[model samples]
Target chain A: MSKYTLREAMAIHASRQIRNEDKVIVGTGMPLVAAIIAKNCHAKDAVMLMEAGPFDSNPLALPSCVADPRGFVGAPWVADPVQMMGMILQQGRIDLGFLGGAQVDKYGNLNSTCLGTYKNANVRLPGSGGASDIGAMAKRNLIIIAHEARRLVEKVDYLTTPGWMLHPYENGKRVKDRLVHRKELGLWGGPEAVVTTMGIMKFEEETKVMYVSEYYADLGVTLEMIKENTGFAIDTSKADQVIPPTEDELYILRNVADPENIFI
Target chain B: MVSESKNSTKKTKIKTLQEAISQIPDGATILFGGWTVTRKPMAAVFEIIRQGKKDLHLVSNPGGPESDLLIGAGLVGISETNFIGHEVLGIPYCFRRAFEKGGLEKTGYLHDDWTVQTGALRILAGAMGIPFIPTKSLKGTEIIDPEHDLLADLRGKSKKLPNKKVEFIQDPFWDEGELLLIPAIKPDYCIIHVPMVGEEGTVRIHGGLFMDFYGALAAKKTIVTTEQITSEDYLKKQPDLNSIPAEFISDIVEVPYGGHPTAVQGMYDLDFEFFNRMVDSTKKEDTYVQWLQEWIKDLPDHDAYLEKLGVKKIFSLRADPGLGYNPRLKRKS
Candidate 1:
């Protein structure tokens, strides 16, 4: 069995969460890596779809973004992106969406939108593509971001995609009503999980608050570190039972990712 | 469709990119051709942003904040691009804030095989005079169902009612339908920026055409912006260099060095400092407008805009133009 690098292990851990029955929509970057790992390991039947309309296809390499045709080079099928947006996403075909964010808040809301305050502040990030739709429409959403205090903040400066608890209406309401009425949507019931380089986090089903669910093995980060970063109490039970990548998982990752030593 | 004669009589005139863009109406869907910052029509794009045309839908390859000028300006209401947010360079603040405020409308597409397959096949469909193309693509996936509505609009009269029961197709041997069909897309207008064009509107692109030429051909209308304009004789001299002939061109505006701030292949490297400033400026609509007014509005025309670049800077740019610059013979020392 090949040895896995820390990045691979982290990726695998995130990947294992996807269920075979789930329809997965993934964006670029580490999220793509994690989804691939999930497909190669636990979620074989998971329908892999990209925002660009490639389904269950293995790209030659991870695309820089969703539009780079390189991502769908090895896919089983490809479709027009405009069709994907106008028809598929609007119709609500995607089940689970996996995205990466620059910042995530206590409620699991994300801010990939900007670095500073809204309206005349600092750095501007890429605005939402379909993320707003995914955040609003997808049955389930998962976000993967690197673990850092700066990233896991109390409140995101910008809400690129507002999550569930932040919804305006309670229980079942029209999507538009819930989006429009809410003065501020907190991460009440939005993201199912947030995978990080340091550990995995999930919202408490009852409280709709973020809590640490898992931690990587052989890593020096502590539960307190997670708490310090997140500013919330974490469930140790889930964190301790975190699954480690198997030997076979390591083999696939090393062969697939094969990061250069210098870059690593 | 508008008749060709109506467009044929339209005079081809010299204008800066901004002035050319000012002519476009509101709610116009524009197809921006370029791969990221490589060959974008920056001047036209900047002018569009400055004009603050609302409900603009842009179709192009996603290139982060460098490409977010429209989004930042609150001009973009819809996009059929692949990605946004700066992955490497830095995100544009205006776009980010607008997103956070839920003020922008956006649609993302996948890149890679899907983008190429769809774009290529759709263009082929248009070129072939077909309404749609059938491919094995998206077969067996959730995208196959009309309920998934990957192509069929499920809202208003165009709404596709979901028939959830998967039906079996009866054949001589097999009794089941095997695949799903994805519809083709023909854009309303395609905007292209090239290295050079002749007076007759013959375009010459230096690098791989990618899907730009196909998109232009497939679109109903084609608008071209170029970095340099030469005589019609020069175009005839190099017939092989022309990617799209004058017949294909619907409207041509000679905008010399049109792609400013954004990189133009064989012309200039991306003005990162300007991009960063734009990113910072995008945070507020007023500021963004002010920035646009300062850079784009004040420039009277393309010639004046080029003059703003200054001869010394242009000479420096000419000396080491990245991809397509050809050195002219030096005078005897």
Candidate 2:
């Protein structure tokens, strides 16, 4: 049996989605680790961008934060928030983006703003810094968050960032009472996939509703276990056991990317 | 020396923290430059807290400790911008407490949120001396929903804020597509911390410019705090390095380690221990008060603040000459 933690598995699995030479915007935490590991492994040409201004940062080691001075070390060009956000991201130059939030709905709608209401909240989270823009503009995005019934809700408390949203899925038709698609809002894309502790979930191409695409059977995470942890009704027909983290990927994660276990 | 002689007639804007911050009136809209952890003007923020400046409207693209300190001290009444938490540090404890707890009740706090790109575009519009900017961001999201406009009643009533959060309309030129016309932000004061500033008020930023350049240009006036102060002649020797002109600055304060706990790229790295201390100290209302007393109230000046942290702790965070960050520093726990 291969030995690996769940977080390492999640990060390694998430890194596989990134393709070579794609420009990606990443924040802190697992997203950061995933991007670094992707660059250190197969996607060597993947460009990493940060809101704090590094366009393409290839760091010596995993920098502590996005604004870690290592971000500036190997960057080709540094930009302000306006240039990075407006000139690049909003203009749709970014290929992929990463987001994490307090709540992620079945449609991948994220709420990083607040819990109860805008005026008052049960739990007040950090409002959208760039999650909305990234969600709205990135051609494809990945969501990294802990898995729990409460977190994977049927409906988010606040729609801080847009995802593939639909209240009902009847007769394979998407448009009904009130329907909103990324294309309808002039947005290019929604979440491509959500990588969780259980496995990975991908949205249906037509309906844009999330489905369990893969599960970590080795970690004792079955379709029933994944479904039990989900708050919304989901389709498990397409679910399959995920590819386990390879020794090479795990080595790159431990030695090349995050040697100190900062993010892992 | 022709450039120096011609600029000599211009006023020198150097001032103490008190001198610069005291001039700021209550209830003025303010913007602090920096994204998350880099180049935050903590010195001015401390002085603002010490002076008990209240009713200020704080705006930043992605705020960190500078914004949190003000919010924690109950200084800001209205916060409009993209965010207010450290990117890696999870979230700002005080910003979280201010909303969940009754901390902001006294200030009648109001918060209106926007996305990152749109928010930065608003500031860019301000810098461009425009009234509004149109973008395709936040179209179907709740951000443009009329019901969520917290600044609804205060729209057009305030001098600084816009009449609405964002005006959604069909693209006038195309007339078929839709876009959002977000308002510009013109703050009364723009506070920034940079590594270098000339005695004659020429600003030079070595690393990422971040949002400081736009923030300075958009505000009515700017207060710059620097780690090193050089002569105009020295900085002018390398002209391409300079960003804002001398005329743009209203005041410049020389504070060597102005952005401690956070970071100022070329000079130092993030003091994670200190950051965790700030986060942990602000976990509870009582602990936060004690933290205020220990860090801000007890210390009268920047030197005292640095002394409290000690030279060892400060020096340990110094950036490696080549890497621009301390290579030996331990971040992972």
Top model by DockQ, which number? Answer: 2
Whole-model alpha-carbon lDDT for candidate 2:
0.83
Stretches off by above 4 angstroms in model 2 are A166-177, B1-7, B101-107
Per-prediction DockQ, in order? 0.06, 0.52
> lDDT per residue, candidate 2, A139-258, as tens digits?
999998877888998888888888987332223222237876767656787899999989999999888888999989978888988889998988999999988988889999989888
What is the alpha-carbon RMSD of candidate 1 to the true structure? 11.8
Q: What TM-score goes with each of the models?
A: 0.54, 0.95
Question: In candidate 1, what are the lDDT values of residues B137-158, reduced to their tens digit?
Answer: 2222111223322223322343
Candidate 1 per-residue C-alpha lDDT over A1-264 given as tens digits, one digit per residue, 9 for 90 to 100:
455555666677777778887777777666676676677777777877766556665654444444443454556655444445445654567678787777887777777545665433355455454554465446678888878888888767656566544433222222323332112332112478888877888877666667778777556667777767664445555676466678877665656542322011
Give candidate 2's error at residue A33 in angstroms.
0.6
Error of 2 at A238 (Å): 0.9
Alpha carbon lDDT of each predicted model: 0.57, 0.83
Decoy 2 TM-score against native: 0.95
